[model samples]
Target: MQITLMRHGKPVLAASRWLAPCEMGHWIAAYDEAGVHVDAIPPASLAAASTAVIVFASSLPRAQSSARALGHAAPRVDALFREAALPFPLWRCPRLPPFAWAALLRLAWLCGYARGADALATVRQRARAASAQLIAAAAAGPVLLVGHGIMQRLIARELRAAGWTAVSRHRSGHWGMARYRLD
Candidate 1:
């Protein structure tokens, strides 16, 4: 059985503006609601998606839109595949661009700064469940998952632990793909 985890296409949301730490919450909300730029999807992603017998996507607009753009008109949607919640600090100074803030916040989150968001352990558990779901789906044939970068990485770890062999190097960028197969 084979399973492929693909990051969604570039989101339509603009992340170039500088923002205070406290203002990141609003940005995160907007990003969650934003869709992908269909024209920005890579041809390789489209080709990989076409080889899958089943497609899955996160409930987020970006992932769903990516699935559609890749030719899956109705991918199975599930919150289990959603990106891990990003936690923002309440500090009012040191304004940074959205991407910079996301990087710092993600590092803080990894260091145990959940700030009311789902804890890393909880997110790992979810990844394990998501991995199981994908593996089950792959029993029918190749499975394609249009998901977020971080979540895809977490799920890839779980797939590896479950005895799946990585068929390709995993990429963490938008429109990147990681392929695995159960031997």
Candidate 2:
């Protein structure tokens, strides 16, 4: 059985501005609500979507819209595939771009700074569950999951642990794809 994890298309919400750490919550909220940028979707992603017998997506607007943009009008939407929550530090100095803030906050979260977000352990458990669900779905045919980058990485790790071989390099960027198969 084969399963492919694809990061959703670029979000419509631009992350060009520098933001204070405390403002990350509002930024994240807006990002979660934003849809995909249709024009930015890679051609390879569309080709990958066409080959899947079943499509799954996170309930977040970006993922859902990405699925639709890829022509999966009725993908199985689930909160289980949502991105891991990001924790924002309260420090007011050193404002950074959204990407930098996200990276730094994610690293802090991994180091146990989950003041207002799900713990790393909790997200790992969820990844295990999500992996199992995807594996089950792959029993019938190829499965494509349109999901967030972090959650997709966790799920890919779980799949590898479960003996699935990577068929392609896992891509973490928007519109990137990773393919795996169980022998």
Candidate 3:
């Protein structure tokens, strides 16, 4: 089985809202007042994954936008492959202190949220679950799964843990495409 994980394109922030008590210490909100559109990478990474059988994207517009650029005739949207939900919004995390960060991370862990497991162990478990489902579906075909940054990393990490050598990663939260082949 082979799979590829890709991050979403740029996104616009929604209306401003007050932070929750748990988020008080760990949130720092920013604005792109004129909601900005994420620029498409001149050349997309999906083209390199030409051998893929089907393209999949997260249920988010940003991801769908990037998947459309794959040059594929059709890209399927998959909700199970959505990005990990951070304890706080992704847009509100520039000023959080270490303790608060730890607290939120702990919160994520305490909950049954496997996507943001808050530890490498949890990441591996979540990745394996996703990979197992993929393997069960098509044990001998190439598939593309577009998701968020953390999930992508966890997927790559799980692939490595499952004995895939030669794993590589691009910059965080940036456009990325990874290929994995299972022997």
Candidate 4:
């Protein structure tokens, strides 16, 4: 069976200006609410999605929109597959681009700087649970997941741990896909 963990399409939101560390909280909120550019989904990825027996999407707006772009008028929306909560750093730091804040926050989160947000351990558990669901669905046929970048990476790691092998990764920008197969 085949399984594909796909990053959602490019979001409509933009980092038009530099932001202070504190401003990133608001940016994160907007990012969570943003919809994807549906037209940007590559034809090849769309074709792959169309072949899936089941399509799943994180409950976030971006992910849900990506599923529709893949031709699934309605996909199984699962909050369990949502991206790990980004920790909002409330410390003083040099003002940087919004994307820079995102990258720094992610790095900080990895280094155990999460204040009261979703702990790293919690994310790992969710990844395992979501991975199991995909594996179960694979028994029936192909499964496609249109999810966030980091969430897709987490799921891919879980799939590899479960003995699935990587097939190919499409260079489709935000809509890129990491393919895996149980052989």
| CA RMSD of each candidate after superposition | 1.0, 1.3, 6.4, 1.6
lDDT of 4 at 64: 96
lDDT of 4 by residue, 30-139 (tens): 99999988775677788889889999999999999989888898999999999987887675667899888788888988888787568788888899999999999999
Please provide, for model 3 over 8-89, each residue's C-alpha lDDT reduced to its tens digit, 9 standing for 90 to 100: 6555655434554345333322321122254665354646446667777666666776666565546777665655544444
Please, what is the whole-model Cα lDDT of each candidate in the order they appear? Answer: 0.93, 0.93, 0.58, 0.86
Question: Candidate 3 or 4, higher lDDT?
Answer: 4
Give the runs in model 3 whose Cα sits over 4 Å from its true position: 14-38, 42-44, 89-126, 137-140
Model 2 TM: 0.95
What order do you get sorting by TM-score, best first? 1, 2, 4, 3
Instruction: Give the Cα error of residue 152 in candidate 2, in Å.
Output: 0.7
Deviation from native of the Cα of residue 92 in model 1, angstroms: 1.4
Residue pairs in collision within model 2: none
Count clashing pairs, candidate 2.
0
Off by over 4 Å in 2: 14-16
* Better by TM-score, candidate 3 or 1: 1
Candidate 4 lDDT: 0.86
